[model samples]
Target: MIRTHQGINTDDDLKPDLTPLLDIIFIVMVFLLLTASVKLQSLDVDLPQTDTRTLQTTQADPITINLMSQSPYWALQGAAVEDWETFKTKLVEAVKAEPEKPVVIGADKTGSVENMLKLLAFLQQNNIKATQLLMEEEK
Candidate 1:
């Protein structure tokens, strides 16, 4: 024999109230939906359309930076840079000349992540926001 509250015996057990649990779950879901819709302000670039057949270039003459596989070596606008000082000097000059020009960074798979991040940080610090990362096509 099973005894319930108030000394009543029946073939039933007390079931938990799920209404409060469901209410908490609903509130959490709504909070997540609101936060997920917000867009972050950072380097924003138009990605290439995979399904489009036409080639589209946004800028007339984009400034390209090629980070070599080796460290302490890079090429800005086709000319080679041996050190960070030279690279920064050239970059500052370029940015001063064309403030609105878009920058395309071509980093090899073997390049150092630290160096790449440093370059990106420099760009962000100097207010050069429009930047693109060039990726190699996989075979």
Candidate 2:
């Protein structure tokens, strides 16, 4: 008479082969290295640092052009122009007199984009340069 016990092979069932996982990880590593090297080769020059002490000054206060939802406005030395015709006239005169003077545009967030485009076109037509967009700080 012999005593015999038959049981399931738990170790063989629980152990998973890691060769496929290692192969996938190696493929991913190789792909990333190739892409990173290619990207590094494309960069051209070093970026410049901001200078905090530089103070910007114009001969006079910058002429500000304001664009509202309904109409366009222009201001100079804290005085608003009467109408668009006057604004254009003043802009042409200023550009002709001193083209180096900077022009700042103050536009409301809800203003019409058409007005801004028109104003930009007018400036370009007159060869006016050195224009900047002005934005109010969030409170």
Candidate 3:
């Protein structure tokens, strides 16, 4: 028969033990630290890097090509291009005229990305490697 201890308080056994819980938590932490994986994702970008000394040597103005959100969406040197054919013709002439000048793509914030991609592909096809971009500063 089990001996009954009436004088002793039985509440001590009712209180939850924390040692096992803490040990499990530490085991989970160690497992996560060992099994976690880290990977870095990045893309190669072509960004213009200019120096003040180099700027002083070349005074040539950059050829600005604007991509608008409207019907006449393309602009070469601040003039709106009528159509794709005209844009190609004018761009070819401009590139040929000033081979040393950097081509700056100035796209409107509301403009479609398709136009920008087309412009980039055209530049690639024409082998215009020296290119820059213009973006409004975030206020």
RMSD (Å) per prediction? 12.4, 18.1, 17.9
List ranges where model 3 is wrong by over 4 Å: 1-60
Which residue runs of candidate 2 sit more than 4 Å off their true CA positions?
A: 1-60, 70-72, 137-139
Q: Name the lDDT of candidate 3.
A: 0.69
Whole-model Cα lDDT of every candidate shown, in order = 0.69, 0.58, 0.69
Over the stretch 45-135, how does candidate 3's per-residue lDDT look in tens digits?
A: 2323433342221123667777887778888877888898899899899989988776767677677789889888988998986455654
Q: Per model, how many backbone clashes are there?
A: 0, 0, 0
TM-score of each: 0.56, 0.48, 0.56
- Worst 10-residue stretch by lDDT in candidate 1? 38-47
Better of 2 and 3 by TM-score: 3
**Model 3 quality (TM-score):** 0.56
lDDT digits (tens) for residues 29-50 of candidate 2: 9987664431111111122233
Instruction: Order the numbered candidates by lDDT, best leading.
Output: 3, 1, 2
Clashes of 3: 0
lDDT of 2: 0.58
Better of 2 and 3 by lDDT: 3
